[model samples]
Each structure stands twice: as structure tokens, then as C-alpha cells.
Target: MPRILLIDDDEQLGPPLAAYFQRFELALTQALRPSEGLALLAQGGFDAAILDVMLPEMDGFELCRTLRKTSDIPVLMLTARGDVMDRVVGLELGADDYLPKPFEPRELVARVQTVLRRRRTAAPAELDPDEWRFEGGLSIAPTRRRVLREGTEVELTGTEFELLLLLAREPGRVFNRDDILNQLRGHEAELYTRAVDIVVSRLRKKLEPLDAIKTLRNAGYALALRRLP
Candidate 1:
């Protein structure tokens, strides 16, 4: 069973949700305080983490930032419904995905499963090369699940790496927001198009000097880099 940690201050939220998650064969552990959650995470053995943005003691964003300094464990953030900035900030903080409050447990489970899938598989296709080399010293090794920029290793979260891999597989192939959200999240979300833009912005920053991703006016985004000869 995959273990999951949920960091939320809602004292009444854990037991019932834990029971629900158990039905899916996922072991859910709840931490009512950020300090407690950080302690539990420090002990290790969690496959993923679900954080509530409104938590006490430095909030979920700070916890995520601190945790990211040491681990790449998949993260799903719970944001306030209708707060676009909340979702955007979570993604900006390296959250693998986000779900709004008042969400169905079933939907949350589905999102968690999608995040796990992303962590497991990132390459575009089975027949693609083990490593993809692009122009301007960018290379992605799918087998190793690593990216290198100009010969130096670049650290990317699972979501970021997966998006990059998707675009690199077919350089210049336009991937509209809906398509990207589907490919990456496994569900259609009308509000998540901005999520795509936020991720692209992050990728652009990390891939500086190369201008590796191009935005097509109202069409979509594509890998601007070409394969290395």
C-alpha cells in the first residue's frame, strides 16, 4: 500500500478521510500541525503528500518550500475554491497538482492517482529513445528520469520533467492547454489553463538563455528547441 501524508489543521478531517483513502488501498496519515507534519515527513516512508494552503504555522507554501529543499516526493495542494492565485502559488511552489476546497473525496483520490502515475512514468512513448538530446545542450534521459542543461544536471520536479518530456518527444508539436492538462493530470479542468501557463513560466525560468518553450498566440505551447545533431 502506498503511504500518503496529509497536512491540514482541521482536527476533524483526518479520521473519515483516512478511512475513505483506505478503501483505495492508500494509507493516509494526517498531521494536524505543520510542525508535527514536518516531523512525520522527516521519518520518511511517505509516497506522497497532500497539503492544505490554509494551515497554521507558516502555511502550506512554506512547508512545501522547506520540504522541497530535500525531497522530490509528489505533492498535491488543497487550495481555496475560486482563488486562482492560491492554485497558481501552489504550483509555483513545486506542487505536483492542486485541488480546490469543498472537493469530492473521489476527485481527490483520482488526482492523487494521477500524480502517482506521473511519478512512475514520464516519457512520451515506449519506443522513444532512452535519452532525448535537444539543441542548446538540453538532454533528457527518460530511463534515468533526469534532465541536463548545457552538460550540468538540472533538477526538475516530476510534473515539470513530464511536461518537458512531452514537448521534447515531438519538438514543435502544439500542445494546447486542454491537451496538456489531460496528458498531465488525466482530467479536464476549465480553470486549469492558467495552471499550464504557470508551469510554462517556471520551465522557462529553469531553462534560461535557451528560450526552450514557445507559446502560440491562442493555439498552445511547443518545444522551441531542436534535436542536437
Candidate 2:
């Protein structure tokens, strides 16, 4: 069973949700405060984390920033419905995904399953050459799920890493918004096109100086780097 840490202060939300998750073999652990949640996270044994943006002391984005500094545990943020900025900022802060509040429990479960699946299969057992080297000193090792620039490791979330891998695998192939969304989520989200752009922008920022990603206005994005021999 996968253990999920949910850091939200809603006194009424956790219990019933936990019960519902159990039906899918998911164990949900709730923390009423960010400090408590961080403590639990540090102790480990969590498959993923679900954070609520509106918290008492510290917000979810700050917590996510702090968590990414040490752990790459998949994060699924819960934000207020129609809070576009919250969702975008969460993704930029290294959250694997986000689900707006006022959502169905079934939708939440689907999102959790998607993120967990990505985490479990983010890396493959073999690459034709084990490592992919690109111009401007960027390298990716799919088997290890590691990225490097000028010999230095670049930490990336599972979603970011997968996005990079997808584009890098087919350099110059323009992946439109729908294609990118479908590739990442295993389905298309017509209303979440901005989500795709946010993720791409975040990935590009991490690959700075190399400029490994190129954006095409009104179209989509593609890998800007060329394979190195």
C-alpha cells in the first residue's frame, strides 16, 4: 500500500477522505500543520504528499520549496478553485501536479494514481547509450533519472524530468499543448493548457544557460539542443 501524506488543516476533510482512500489500497496520513507535516515527511516512508495552499502559519508553496531542497517525493497541491496563480506557482515550485479544491474525491484519486505511476516509472531500465548527451553541456541519463549540466547535477521533479526526456527524445519535434498534456497526464485537459506552459517554463529555467528548450508561439515547444557525439 502506498502511504500519502496530506497536509491540510480542514478538521472535517481528513477522516472521511482517509477512509475513502483505503478502498483503493492507499493509506492517507493527515497533518493539521505544516510543521507537523514536515516532521512526518522527514521521517520518510511516504509515496506522495498532498498539500493545501491555504494553511495557518506557512503556505503550501513555501513548504514545497523547502521540501524540494531535500526530497523529490511527488507532490500534489490542492488549491482554491479558479486560483490560477496558485496552481501555476505550485508547479513552478516543483510540485508534480495540482488539483483545485471543490473537486470530486474520485478525481483526486485519479490524480494521485497518475502521480504515483509517474514516480514509479519515471526512469527506464535501459537507454540505447545509457546517457544522452546534448550540446551546451547538458546530459540526461534516463535509466538513472538524472540530469547534468557541465558535469553538475540538476535536480528535477519527476514531471519535469519526464517532460525533458520526452522532448529530448525527439529533438525538434514540436509537441503542441494537447500532446504535452496528454503525454504527462495520460489524457488531455483542454482547460489546463496553462499548466503545460508553466511546467515547460519551469523546466527551461532549470536548464538555464544551455537553453535546451525552445518555444514556438501559438504552437508549442521543442528541444533546442542537438545531440552530441
Candidate 3:
């Protein structure tokens, strides 16, 4: 049974979610306060966590950061705001996913399952000698679904990691916005294209030592494999 810790101040939603997940055989623990959730997390293990952005004591973003510092336990943040900034901030703070408030319980369940599945599938493999290495400190560990810099781990949101992995896999291969978006999300490409650019910009900033990724005018982006001293 996958143990899930759900932290949300919405009293009415907690028990029902717990009940719903129980039917699926997931062991669920509900926490109404941030402190309570942190306590449970510190005490030990959980397969995943569903955190609400707005908490009485500490907000989900802070909690997420704190949790990431100690453990890589996948986290899904809940926010009623639905603002893109909130979602971006949550992701930057190392959240696996963010579902806006007033969301359907079933959708929540699906997101939880997706995150868990991703984590489970990400088992580290031995690095191959001929693997592509970006000039900057960035390197992708595909099997592990992790990115590292100078041998130090860099926390990446799920989407950002996918984008980085795809681009890094084929260095110098320019993937237009549509191609990249479709590949990253496993969905049809959007007509209007800024989504891919946005994700790439966010990813580039996180990948260091800087200048490893270059944007092509009227084309797309490519990894600059020329090493930097």
C-alpha cells in the first residue's frame, strides 16, 4: 500500500479524500495543519504528499522547500488561486505538481497516481561513457529522472525535468516549440507556441554553470556542448 500524507486546512475535503483513496487501497493520513504535516513527515516515510498552498501556520511552498531539503518525496501542491505565478513558484520550490483548488477529487487522484508512477519509474542507472554531456555543469540522468551540476543534485519540477531530458538527449538538435511541447507532455502540439519557450526559459536558469543552452533565432533551442572552464 502506498502511504499518502494529505495536508489541507479544508476540513470537509480531507476525510472524503481519505475515504476515496482507501477504496483504492492507498493508506492515507490527513493533516489539517502545516506543523502536523511536517511532524508526520519528519517522523518517517510516505510514498507521496498532497499539500495545500494556504495553511494556517506555514504555507505549502515553505513546507515543500523544507521537505525537499531533507527528502525527495514527491509532492503535489494544491492551490485555490489558479494563478500561473503560484503554480510556477510551487514548481520552482520543488513540487512535483500543482492542482488548483475547486478541483475534482478524481482529478486529484489521477495527479497523485501520475506523480507516484513517475517517481517509481525513475530508478537510477549506470551512466554510459558516450552519453552526451552539456558544457555547463548540467547533466541528465535519464533512468533516474534527475539532473545534476558539478556532482550536486538540482531539484527540478516534473515538467522542467522532462524538458531538460528531452533536449539533452539529442544535443544540438533543434526542437521547435511544437515538437518540444508535444514530446514533453505526450500531447498534441498547441497552435500558439509560447508554452515551450516559457518552460525552457525556466529550465535554462536552473541549469548551471550558465551558458550551456542557447536559443536559435527563428528556430528553437539547442544544447551548447562546448565545455566552459
For candidate 2, the per-residue lDDT at 229 reads: 71
- Poorest 10 consecutive residues by lDDT, candidate 3: 183-192
Q: Cα deviation in Å at residue 190, candidate 3? A: 11
lDDT of 1 by residue, 111-154 (tens): 89888778777454663677789889998898678889999987
Scanning candidate 1 in windows of ten residues, the lowest lDDT window is: 121-130
lDDT, candidate 1, at 131: 78
Lowest-lDDT window of 10 residues in candidate 2? Answer: 120-129
- lDDT by residue for model 2 (51-140), tens: 999997899999999999998889999998887788778988989888888989998989999988876674444444679999899999
Q: What is the TM-score of each candidate against the true structure?
A: 0.89, 0.90, 0.76
Best by lDDT: 2
Q: Report lDDT (Cα) of residue 163, candidate 3.
A: 69
Clashing pairs in 2: none
Off by over 4 Å in 3: 122-138, 183-199, 217-219, 226-229
Pairs in steric clash, model 1: none
Give the Cα-based TM-score of candidate 1 against the true structure.
Answer: 0.89
